[model samples]
Target: MPADRPYDRRRLLRDAAVGAAAVSTAGLATGVPARAAAPAPAGAPITAARARRSGAVSFRWWGTAGWRIDIGDRTVLVDPYLSRYDTGLFTGRFNPDTPLTVDAARIDPLVDRAENILVTHTHWDHFNDVPHIAVRTGARVVGTLTAYHLGLAYGLPAGRLAPVKGGEVLDFGDYTVEVVSSLHSRNGSWSLAFPGVRVSPPPRPEKISDLPEGDTLAYQIRVAGGPSVFFTGASDLNERNLTGLTPDVAMVASAATTSTADYVPRLMAALDHPKIVVPVHWDNFETPLTNPPTVAASDRERLDDLIAAVRKASPRSRVLLPEYHTAYHF
Candidate 1:
């Protein structure tokens, strides 16, 4: 294998373990208090005073497929997987069948202010940290029935868990969130790295890998009188579901190795081409959070391809490459 291939499982697991331990210890030593403000219901109007108090919608990327969106007095999270796991030690080997090994201390700071959590699927990286975040922040957890069961197993209060099978439009006071049915990327060299799997409900499994991809979803979040944003955690898209949906900003996953070769253009066309596109999930996940993001030799090419595709398909769309932990106001 090339030295900079970036998917060396053994090396990734080893480093992740060490990094997780350090983060856990540090987080325990200096944990931030969870915010007490509750999230407003969808469709709630954003008054001028409230808008001035909260300013414009701000988005912060938390590595992997996690995003923190703050609008008015409400904060919503999408596919937050801040608990870096040491997947190299799983018994299932390449499969994601492993017990949840979340670094709670590490995740506390990122989720302290969140009032709502939206999960795209039940994959380890997209859903692992959600239970902890919900419990800590008193945020509503929204997703498939599988995700709700996982939350229940993780001890989340029933009231905080909202189960859905897509096609739900929620009113959160200052913003409206629409849940659209979506599809996970195919399992192949240029798609999701693991086999596409789903877990049965009623009794949540003890292992993380057992947590299946119940149902994939994409979120079209429209802030009252503010920018509308669309989020897709996986590379695949259901064109019919997204047709006629035009968002001002689109956060598209850019992991080339785990995506179809032409995902970018297809996604762009499906959403009617947004004005701004942000490439996310392009960073190597196995690496530690404290370390700077590393673009694998192969990923660099994939990113270039994505950019070219975006330009060709949507010439007017501005592609923004976000830095980790940095907030982008829209």
Candidate 2:
């Protein structure tokens, strides 16, 4: 099992968790800190869509901690739990719905055309509607063993869903994807938080019949010419996790509650890969507040704390605090 609580791990994870003190570029700007891009070759601005597609990876946020990546001509959607389900899911547990402002509809188009869907885990908010999507879009689903099984449970064919083991890669004709591991608990169902508070309540004691909710997971995908992208669903940073891959861009969960709050420094440290850092799993829910076992106020404060820590550790990396519906090129 992972350490009961992180120790040196904490110290390392906090590399990006520097307090509000001034960061010393200290001449390392040329190193992992800042890499100057070569001058853009002058060319007529062609069709913007073609320009956008020319990028090695086209990434966009689809609410929550989910992302859409287009590698060359292959399109991959990760952890899309798009729903305006009841807010009662988060009310009293996490932070309140203080969204960073992005449209969900814009994300809908991408989902409709996704060629492949990879769920990092099985959380309702991450895997929702995915089964139907796979059926509708003819997209293959790849993820952790459990994720593949979860898709199977939703009526997906065994052939359409591939169970990925860490260190292995799945090729989609246009690109490749790899499944990674994480130390998150699924025995405990997934829950939402509202500003260090519970914005919603839990299912009735009787309705608690649904087995544990979801598990967290990580992923690595490589496109023909794009740098590899690493995505962590959520977990306490583990050294064993940094294996078999070099991430050119990494996306990790930043749910402002117990898990994210406690492990920010450590997790980020283990992911000290020099690349683009994208934040996911923030404060956003569509349901009305009315649930049990909600977030205890203490957990809500974790989000702000994690963000602060990241500011310190990764001042060198471009931090993308994405809006729900915008596209980013990597």
Expressed as tens digits, the lDDT of each residue in 1-330 for candidate 2 is: 133322222211111222222123332222243222222223443332453345434676665556766554456788765554542333332222322222345345545566778776554555555776787688888766655655655667889886665666676655677766664421112232110211122231111112122444577776655567787665444556775466777776654334333465555566664466665554343421122111223334444455566667765565554444445666
> Which regions of candidate 1 are displaced past 4 Å?
1-54, 89-98, 189-204, 255-261
TM-score versus the correct structure, for each prediction: 0.79, 0.65
Q: Worst 10-residue stretch by lDDT in candidate 1?
A: 13-22
lDDT of 1 by residue, 267-315 (tens): 8888888888877766656556654454444335556666677888988
Off by over 4 Å in 2: 1-53, 93-110, 185-215, 255-262, 287-301
Q: Which candidate is the best by lDDT?
A: 1
- True lDDT of residue 114, candidate 1: 76
lDDT of 1: 0.67
